[model samples]
Target: MQWLKVIFAGFIEIIWVTGINTANSWWSWLFVLFVIALSFYLMISACKHLPVGTVYAVFVGIGAVGTVIVDIVFFGESFNIIKISLIILLVIGIMGLKLATEEGDE
Candidate 1:
């Protein structure tokens, strides 16, 4: 459940980051702000129960990997072997962090 919060926060992070790139109007900017707030709120909640360093690392990993995928799929960013390889490495690092820590450990 705590990990879920971190995952959701990471997902929200991706939305806000994309919004930062695409938002052009006042309302869109406001929406981005809202999403940012929600993402941080979720992160803070997760931090209360999990190791902050691990939680933050995983959260950022998700956001970074997801953002790149978003760019490739939606924004037509060029895909390359190096980008994909790095993404895979990042995913492995995230999983390793998850495995290294036990739930409820501070």
Candidate 2:
């Protein structure tokens, strides 16, 4: 379904972003570029079914939060209260947007 496509796109976005962190050499950068291109394609496909604004907002928001979590767990990045609070706000915003879009569809 459309939601499945959106979820898949989000997953692809995560892969692309994670690739950026692992890229240390030219070959790795090239791989990252390929993943980025694939992510873009998936995003475009998702937009075909979901509203552009909703899809883009959700995609970027989820990607950012997911990347931050990856950094915290894998790279030993700081996991302070402030950062966690901001992430919570971002989740709230994403949920609000989804609800608004659903209401508008009805």
Candidate 3:
């Protein structure tokens, strides 16, 4: 459940970060703020039961990867082999960290 919160927060992070890049209207800005608050709250709640470093790392990893994909798919950012390779490497690293983390360590 805690991990789920972290995951949700990470996706929310992606949303707000994208929002910041593209938001121009008042309502869009307000939505961004709401998502930021939601993500922060989720992060804090997850931290209470998980290793902070692991939680934060995973959260940022998700946001980073998601943002890159969003840029490519929605924003028409150019895609290249190098970008995909790096993203794959990052996913491996995130998985490694997740696997390395133990419940007892929390």
Candidate 4:
């Protein structure tokens, strides 16, 4: 479904952030590029069935929060209460956006 595609695209976008950490060679670059392309393609496809503004905002918010968690967990980035609280806020915002969707928008 459209929501599935949107969620997948958003989740995979974490690769855009962490890929740089692993892109020390040409092959890595190619792989990351492929991921980027696929993510965008999925987003575009989902837009056919969902509101672009809602989908984009939710996707970016989820992706940003996901990337931050990925960095902190896997890349040894510093973790703090502020970051945690901000992530909570981001989750709430995403939920609000999703809930705000009109029945006709689905």
Instruction: After the best TM-score superposition of candidate 4, give how far the Cα of residue 53 lies from its true spot, in angstroms.
Output: 0.9
User: Can you write out model 2's per-residue Cα lDDT over 1-106, one digit (the tens) per residue?
Assistant: 6656666767777877888878899999998898788778877887877788888888888888888998899889998999999999998998888888964442
Error of 1 at 32 (Å): 0.2
Model 4: lDDT equals 0.90
* Per-candidate local distance difference test: 0.96, 0.82, 0.96, 0.90
> Whole-model lDDT for model 1 versus the true structure?
0.96
Ranking 3 against 4 by lDDT, winner: 3
Winning candidate number (TM-score): 1
Ten contiguous residues with the weakest lDDT in model 1? 97-106
**Considering only N, C-alpha and C atoms within 3 Å, which residue pairs clash in candidate 4?**
none
lDDT string, candidate 3, 3-81, tens digits: 9999999999999999999999999999999999999999999999998998999999999999999999999999999
Q: Against the correct fold, how does model 4 do in TM-score?
A: 0.95
lDDT of 3 at 36: 98
TM-scores, one per candidate: 0.96, 0.86, 0.96, 0.95
Clashes of each: 0, 0, 0, 0
Clashes in candidate 4: how many? 0
Model 4 RMSD to the real structure? 0.9
lDDT tens digits, residues 1-106, model 4? 8989999999889887689677998999998999999999999999998999999988898799999999898989999999999999999998999999997998
lDDT of 1 by residue, 1-106 (tens): 9899999999999999999999999999999999999999999998999999999999999999999999999999999999999999999999999999975495
The runs of at least 3 residues in candidate 3 whose Cα sits more than 4 Å from the true structure, single-residue gaps closed, are: none
Question: Candidate 1 vs candidate 3: which has greater TM-score?
Answer: 1
